[model samples]
Target chain A: MSHPVACCYLKTGRALMSTQRPDARQLPSRRIADDLRQAIETGELLPGARLPSERELAGQYGTARNTAREAIRLLTDEGLVIPEHGRGVFVRRESPLIRLGNDRYSHKYRESGLSPFLLECAKQGKTGRFEVLSIDQAQPSAEVARHLRLPMSEPSVLVRENVFYADQDPVHRVTTYIPWTIAEGTGLLNPEVGHPYGIHGILEERGHTMTRLRESVSARMPKPEETRYLHLPPAVPVLDVLHLSIDQDHNPYELTRFVMRADLTGLLYDTPIE
Target chain B: MSHPVACCYLKTGRALMSTQRPDARQLPSRRIADDLRQAIETGELLPGARLPSERELAGQYGTARNTAREAIRLLTDEGLVIPEHGRGVFVRRESPLIRLGNDRYSHKYRESGLSPFLLECAKQGKTGRFEVLSIDQAQPSAEVARHLRLPMSEPSVLVRENVFYADQDPVHRVTTYIPWTIAEGTGLLNPEVGHPYGIHGILEERGHTMTRLRESVSARMPKPEETRYLHLPPAVPVLDVLHLSIDQDHNPYELTRFVMRADLTGLLYDTPIE
Candidate 1:
């Protein structure tokens, strides 16, 4: 029951406007930023194209050097451009979009020896790996407890955390939770399950074959810790994907939350329309 | 093939860190912003709670008032808080998350008189409406043309643009394109389709019964025009959903792009994992 805060005034027909006219009263920096942003969007400035130096921009726009610097900072905050320490600023090149679809969970692929991340990376000619952060028993959070149908008073979940990487760059931080009943005396408690099918494969062997998956997707600015872990740039948001795997008996057996760098991830879903 | 730009350095095991310690060498403004950001994230400062006055924060943190102001500015840019014209700053209250699921397109709901947006609003107890921005014939973009399998040289699509609002707050900007072959002499060309079944119903009547749908989802920062149209706050990213409708004959019939405010919208997909 999250309530949206009132953040904007009601405006009509604004979208139909053809161009964003430069308002005479706008700050000089904003006008400059808008010009550069349009150029980037319209392909005038391609990805990885270096922007004119602040001095040149200032001279061209007839603004102060600080005004030009502020405009660059504005683009940097929007994630449109990156400023190198010694080099000039350039448009940020996007990562290859890895489209995750419903078929990704199919048994055919699950049995393919590669984990889903690695499989997707292989499809796109990129190398993928993950580092296990920890595997330990922990009290389930209220939301996790509700989803897993665990008793309120029980500390009954094994938490496995990992950081997934694409070509050595951190892309997603995944935290998985399993009920102690399902995790105990199983490979689920270990960081490396040493199975081609991974954790889900082990679950299947224990009769918890996944028949369905429900994904809840949202996005938000990364917290400081996530920023550090993901090495996210300023102003880049992260996709928060909450996945629940349901077994044949309709039991929600597993819950995993993936915090992914939005710039590098795309989700595709092809489903029969009911 | 969108390549992810190398944005972050390789980092491992950072997620296991217990706390984000304040670095002694960090700038005063950054350190102050970090403290305030931590307060906001940890619920020490609840949504809508007023932050301390700049003078108070400066005195408390042994920093200049300008430094305190800069810290607050950082929070504002991150969309963690908002400042009033005359009043002090307060933590931003989030909008209620609208969970859009696969069932939203079910024929049962489509037959219910209300449009999909209105139906969802009824369920959520929030008023929803949309303003038809424009309805006109246009040349399809290359992507749209390819999806509809249209000849490259034809102005062969009718485009309908609308802005959806929940509780009077704009939340999504949608642009739908229908190949002229399907749109000719149909209600689909009208801004208001004037039918309970909406556009899909019209497509069905015209022998294009939708059997499947494909949605490609990505996210990024809003362009300046989007910021104005959606009334987005600084640092709020948007979800870009590209939708294609496939008919029973496996013909792609419709293509629509929905640019949604990430802060207020969530997408839910419940599907059997094949």
Candidate 2:
């Protein structure tokens, strides 16, 4: 639990004095990492640029090889660099960011024969497609049931899971849950739900037009399953978005969760002050 | 760059067979970390629960002490656990999550005698306050200039930097940029702008009543300064929000950037579809 650098500071009686000036008290490795991070942030080092080898860094910083290695490890853990076997470490090259705005769900775009994700990709000159992972009936979890306003006695809800890809790279793992009364004996169960309007269109035709939406957004390190599915890089987190669709009568009809790679996604919200 | 365990698998000729099943091919430390992560996620190990000591874990798993340490390090890096000085490692106990929804900006709440951050904190029974870091005139960064439609000839904008606290813990570091044309002689440049409406009210009186807003949200690791300001734990990312305010005449007036701790904030957006 003790850091050698901290011990050195304490022995010198500098730790107490450095409390008023924290930057003066930082470990050598951390200072080196901070300088490299600033270089990356300011575009002094471009993406795919190779960083100096550990030995070179050690020579430049007048530190031990282990100290240099720790600096590089810090950048790797920040998702700013990737080290290749037998090759040098290079700055990470990020995919084009996809911005999801509230207008993506506007009904006006529904007639364009494209789902929201596809439409967004088209606008950005990126190809988008989704693979239907599963469509089945399952008992809704407590959260899902509450969001959909289904009673505990309800038998089951329809679950449709899909992995969406942008430019052939997996970006989102979406799982949608629909009430049994609304999804039973419909095209909702099919893997191929015709596009343009997609599932929302089908729901609208069934007297449940989505008039509103509620989205809760948070971020965290990706789970192992998410890391595997999204092919996430080291230290990359995922944006967890929980979405709810409500009808004109205030009925919450559907609940969907989107797990998106944080490195390649941004969320935008534009609304009135009222 | 070579993993000893992977080398062992290759030596035993099990590498190829295990490729089809990733879970079966995981390194022992990773498997152990995943098991602990699931226990945390499923609430089996509640927040503040102490994990088994490293020696106990090593004995139980029949592994080396270093392997047990690595497993614990993985959990620590994921922000799931914290190692205390002299005490055993314990699960991280998060503060109550503050949900920031669009309604927080509704004009009706402007009369509540509290800023949005303070209002939200009050609702959650937490005290919120802010300390003005600085107020000065600075040339707008390119991005800020573009957002405010300030021509290159424009000299500078009023910059107000503040750090907001929730229950005495710094949660947001906000930097607001206002066009000099609107803030030249206004109270916006003053550290104390009074309560309730605050700077916004002064802008409204100057015929810049904000009617619309656009927020761009992304997540990434905290910078060194942010890590210090927010007192963030290791491996915890932060939410970066860029906010632009527009008046009824569609004039973009204010630009503010909010750097918030991901562990303590959740952004909610509830809006009607067009």
Candidate 3:
């Protein structure tokens, strides 16, 4: 039996075994895949090259043909190669696509003529509700002022906090900001109206229209308060999406910071039609 | 002070408390938002209904006006409410988009392209290589055989396993498979071909043209081997994407399973284009 690829495969196989000794009998395909996979990595077989026939492989490895097939199936799944029916398989070296802002609502839902939250809700076959935690008019904190683009001396700022739930599950926590100047008219400064239309409605009623949005995302370990509100098990990481919506005039009308469970919600992005 | 919406908000807030104490700092705006959010949930607000004015809501809750405004903003960020500049915030609801397979891949790669591994590498401007863990041909277990639609009595299967790394950091662990019959004539079956083209390349050459793919995703606590290979922290979870690709004849030629670190990869889905 010719052992051309076998030698290279064996060398790479040993390097892989150095980490942990797996249960050989339970997962033979894994062991076989690892052997040939290592050979490819070590450059024993050049890229865009062809592999030996299955009969040849079985003889060299002393394994059944099905096991060899499993090894090949694993590589094909990773976008590492292209398989042609009735022909043969070849190496694929195409670079994985690199996308930016694809997880953003601004990119995915902007065109649906619906808000990002609504889109997310209906997709899950669930509904969303906002349970405002606190609403207060106070001197803008330095951080709040920076985010809302309010002056340090801004005498009044509106802070609205809420926990968002889907199917009775707490899915999001957010705090939004609005500077006093933009919020002062039309009796919006009064808290007496209970919870009225969201800021978009109020701003629109006041003649300001939102035209653009910006967001920054980061991941961090969840805090206790977050765990309690989100019903998260300890140590579940959170995806923080902090976004600001600017009106047509390029003025910041709303600054929102959101904390969400990383696993439950999947983000989607759509490229702007060219 | 009237409390038209207070009762509704309090009832739900109490349910969410998990514990019994009611915190006093919570204001009417919160109650209103909560109440309105609940209304939305119970279908009381309907998807397109207009909410009361800030003054109207403030009067309804007997709170100051700013409180009412803040509550609305909270709903906006959660994607429950759509705030049009001039059009008061209305119930923003829409169905989920039907995503195409190609779109899904494009989005996932774009959002986290070359994330941590690439980030570190690019910052230093260095290139890395794939390390083979093991490669061999093995018999397919019942499960592998079922997925491949192959009979158990057929020749042995081909299985390949590998771990991808960047500077020794385990990025992903994969198990690949290919059937013996198709691979028998192809050089891929031979051990001497060793580093032959990636499996995809091998199949393409063998006349198996792959045009469609199916991916099933699940999340779980990482296993010991997964933890060690990916070097994942205890708190982080693992996401497994099982890929099955069939040739033009509708026969699955490859089945590859990939385990990725949740912290390192953020999966993105794209809304199908109409």
Every candidate's TM-score, chain A alone: 0.85, 0.84, 0.54
- Candidate by candidate, in order, the iRMS in Å equals 1.1, 1.2, 9.6
How accurate locally, in lDDT, is each candidate?
0.80, 0.81, 0.58
Show model 1 residue runs off by greater than 4 Å: A1-25, A42-44, A59-62, A153-155, A194-197, B1-25, B59-65, B153-155, B194-197
Runs off by more than 4 Å, candidate 3: A1-127, A138-157, A186-197, A204-212, A218-220, A233-237, A246-253, B1-225, B238-274
Where in model 2 is the C-alpha error above 4 Å?
A: A1-28, A38-44, A55-66, A94-96, A194-197, B1-26, B38-44, B55-64, B194-197
- Order of all candidates by DockQ, from best down to worst? 2, 1, 3
Worst 10 residues of 2 chain A by lDDT: A1-10
Please state the Cα-based DockQ of model 3 relative to the true two-chain complex. Answer: 0.03
Tens-digit per-residue lDDT, A213-234, candidate 3? 6554444456545777898643
Q: Kindly give the number of clashing pairs for every candidate.
A: 17, 2, 119
Q: Give the DockQ of candidate 1.
A: 0.60
